[model samples]
Target: KQDSVVEDISAGCGVINFKVNRKLLVQEDVKFGLTSELFNTLKRGTTLVEYSSPNIAKKFHAGHLRSTIIGNFIANLKQSLGNNVIRMNYLGDWGMQFGLLGAGFGQFGCQEKLKQNPLQHLFEVYVQVNKEAEHNEDMKQAARDFFRQLEQHESEAVSLWQQFREITVDEYQHIYKRLGVHFDIYSGESFHQDQAQEVVQQLQSQGLLKTSEKGTGVVDLSPAGDMSSVCTVLRSDGTTLYITRDLAAAIDRKAKYHFDEMIYVTDKSQENHFHQLFHILLAMGHSWADRCKHVPFGLVRGMKTRSGEVVFLEDVLDEARARMLHNMSQSKTTKEMDNTEDTAEKVGISALIVQDFKGPLLSDYTFDWDRMLQAQGDTGVFLQYTHARLCRSVLLKITKLYLAGGVSIFALCDLYSYDEVLYQSAQDLQPKHLVNFLLKLCHLIASAHRELPVKGSSQVVAQVGRLILVDSLAFNIQLYTVPLCTKHKLI
Candidate 1:
């Protein structure tokens, strides 16, 4: 066994490293998390991850899906290495749009439509109501009045919007559960509505807020915006801006959680907005301002069916599972070997996640089904196939033994045999290197298992040895299944 380099150094009083010379016992089916080796190397800190924020009554798109998975991976990694992690889902359940949804659902929204196609049908009604209001000033007043009613605690408007939001959340929860994701906080812009006013007061008191030429409250980001396009904090009608909501949200989270740091994950277009947000907080004297981060991803073209073509996140999962099922059906593998539907979801989702994470986060990517499912190359299929092979091999292992003194290298009547090439190849390879190797080894193992024979070893010893080998192989395959961090600290 090799000791990590840090094992010999004794520098800090609170922590000390010492070494013991002993056999390195292998644990069965163990998943690595917060190992002493990891904690020793990791610098201490806290982190916040904000992701998977689909707006109220809006279709959950690929971008939101991406944020959900990526932010999750980051939070998982940070927490695994002993950092305080805050997972925030900034749901977009607010704004004048809710007003439109409430108004439309009141008039022409159908019960069946709301049940079967909630987000889309509601969105349809919302778009129509907005268009109608834009052309018919009376419709505009109605929409405004609808929003005001909701704002002023009007029972009917509030009740409908609440139902819409609840149904949307429940539906999304089902989808997220299927996808193996969860959020710690569902902090929305609406949740910060009251906090936004206080933030405004703080800004006003700190002299960060100003009355712009247009009568809306502005944040004096003029110098920050490079002499043009200053940022807005409040509309002329006194409604808070999106950035204002974010400022209040950050403040609320920090005050409540006392996080060591926080991260906001969104697209690049919001870069300027988050910058102004952090600056406003810094001006308000939150020293943790330095800890806030906005992780931006690139544009995804053709994001809607109405826009000629688009990719839905659910569609992506469906395609991946379908393709996986098709491949399994074509394979000579028995149904007993793999569940077509269950394995389909696992393998499909793994493929999706692997593809999304293969490239740098800030880079744009084209979605291609074939590219993601290729079995002969780097892919989730390849990875899963590798895992399955390890499982089978562990289950298939046979122990070899010899008579007390008669066993020879090759002269025995029954000699345990291994593919010379495969055995030789596995020498310098670590466990991870074995996954793809297992793919190639499948045929070899199948043939070898049939042809090879055990020698004079008793069945008990042989069974025990074989079981131990299987456990070793399973442990190794598990190591491959774990995701690596951006810094490659662990896998």
Candidate 2:
């Protein structure tokens, strides 16, 4: 086997001479089956990933961005592994908040402003109404009245609410496009209102619902049957709470998709809420609730842009793009571009995603612009730069082997190390492992590009073998990276 392999040495254009042993194992020769084997063992069932459930008429905050990207990553990974994955964005488009928004819109909303920017106009109205309702009894009553009308589906209230929902969803679709995220099902609490009512009635019939002193409905989730823990289902005003709607949504999804598992992506603060939701579902005799899961992430604090504090998703993305654009403009190595803005956007978003993924999902971290956008270190900017360099180097019109003479080819290629890193990345849902792996790969490729001659080589077989190594490196980097960026629309 060793003699069967080809060996040669090459020197060209003052480039360093290197040799390839006959028995050397290039990256292509190393078989990595750990990740593939694990993936194949998965049950191959449908998975519904519910994430980024932002409320209608509200600014898209940092928490929503975390959920959005994290959910997209999970969905992408599941799909890559052959699961039937469904990405669901459950909007918070119901409850007393809508009542406040309705009354606020009635008081402060301008039709012209709404026509120009529906979401922004509605958000301003909501903020103003909230402030006024705090000190004015009349405003509070008006909000309640508006919400009551909505609950009753009064023609006027329903019309206004429908318009609000449509406009908000339309705006969200565009923003999601910018991020490369999409949803197969866009549902909300409003869609399950009737089902929520049905659930309450059913719980009452089963004697699982108890009326509290305040005229509220509660479900005892205690394992000892002592009612130590309770979950609220209905408010005193006979209005369904958020959990009730969630119950309806879960049951509805189970019936519709028949998914083997459902995952909810949200901040850690809502961990208890999900616990109650799943518990209540189980208590309600839904055996499938056992398969439901909540993947809670930590908070991202102090996120801002050049303008000011980050109040919306758009601001964060825009900040990223602007800063990246500035950096690219100043860099001597930056290639002249047709679409500088698009390149900036992709690179900027990559920086954010890499920063976010570098840490544990449950560990809160303060966002820093300088650190994340740095051209060096383990930042997203570095990742993108490295990938671009690898692509450029591989595409260069040259061919020369760069391995040191008499050196073990295994040490140079590090095929086993790459396999191990990839296996770890696949096992753990963190991107840091993969990020580190690609960083190291980039360093190796850079060394090879500097020392190897691709255009003119004395040894044809050695040149071809080294070119194969470069090609393998580029392919692996793209294989891991393209999915992440594409899933988030950052690419």
Candidate 3:
């Protein structure tokens, strides 16, 4: 069986390879790109993604990096596949932690220091207060009193909390901009405190809320009606717990967004938490909880800067940019470019993302700056360098050909596989497949560039070169344009 599209079929080592016609491949790719019929085949609906979620007034640690990027990737993938995606950042802005922080601020906080460096001042205050409250009975009482005041909506406590929350959000926005991430909504546990009380009332009315021996409000999750599996929703002191606030948040979002699905991205430690959350929701008669998902990722170990153990996300970003700038200066092939700092930042961030995304999402891996930023091998630096070389070698030439009415063509073989990989990535919500696909494509383009001569070749051969260059460039732009590649600028 022979066809025009199949140029040759060969069998070797019990495997068969089909050589696809280059011209037909290009035509098909163009059709696929223009129509996007593949995505149309998949069901499309509104998707809500909740991620990042650093506690207000606390440092954005490296552990948060996984959730932030993974959530952004899911949002990007959903949108690309024709789903209406809503990115939400759920801040931990309430609970006993805030009580301690409030009391600490009242005792040791300085207005000038807070205004100058809000997070730093708050962190210092928190540390100092924790040390004092460990043994000081009076200090512990002050924290409880402050939280009680907050719950009662005392003007002074509420005012201070509002100020801290606003300042923290303002600072976080700048960092998120650097990472090329944004959210449609900024929700917090504070917003649901009152609603959480109402949820407790509902649970009690439904006879699902049980009082444990310690006077805490709990829900029994055991199969045999035993108190073996219990989830606490309230403290004995009559305060709402994390799961209580989460229940309120879920119901609120369902009413507001009416999304078809919702995903929560968090560390693997919270797997049971989400399981208990959805189970409780189902038991409370919210069947839509069945559509909810928890995307748990493993921890990142040994992520440090030259100063010491990294405490903030800003430190990580700065360290990556500085190291990348030093590497660029030492490279013999580095070109003079505008906004060199911006390029270094993008490349460095890409290195971090590629390293984290190369393996299974739930596998804990050690972070090594040297390995991720390597110029060769399966590193992001290699991917960026390959793409830049392709742009330098043939982008301008291809543009001229197109301007002169030359027929446009794309790559052979991989174009078909690219779509399949993308579809699977979206379906499974895994990024490793797409990352590997792009890396393999980069290797192929690099090989084609070395062997094919485009500058002084016949029109047909030049078009073949154009096919490889254009398709590779297109694929790179499509995948890298997302927040995954953060601030990527084409050469």
TM, every model: 0.75, 0.87, 0.89
lDDT of 3 by residue, 304-410 (tens): 89999887788898999999999999999898988889889888888888898888889999999999999988878887887776665456555533333333434
Pairs of residues clashing in candidate 3:
none
Alpha-carbon lDDT, every model: 0.64, 0.79, 0.82
Cα RMSDs, all models: 9.5, 8.0, 4.2
**Better by TM-score, candidate 3 or 2:** 3
**CA lDDT of 161 in candidate 3?**
92
Over 271-366, each residue of candidate 1 has an lDDT whose tens digit, in order, gives: 888888887788789879888878787755443322334334565566678887887777775346445688777777767766666555777787
Best model number under TM-score:
3
**All candidates in order of TM-score, best leading:** 3, 2, 1
Clashing pairs in 1: none
Report the Cα lDDT for residue 22, model 1: 17
Worst 10 residues of 1 by lDDT: 409-418
Off by over 4 Å in 1: 1-46, 222-229, 301-312, 333-338, 396-473, 479-491
> Candidate 2 local accuracy as lDDT?
0.79
Give residue 351's error in model 3 in angstroms. Answer: 1.1
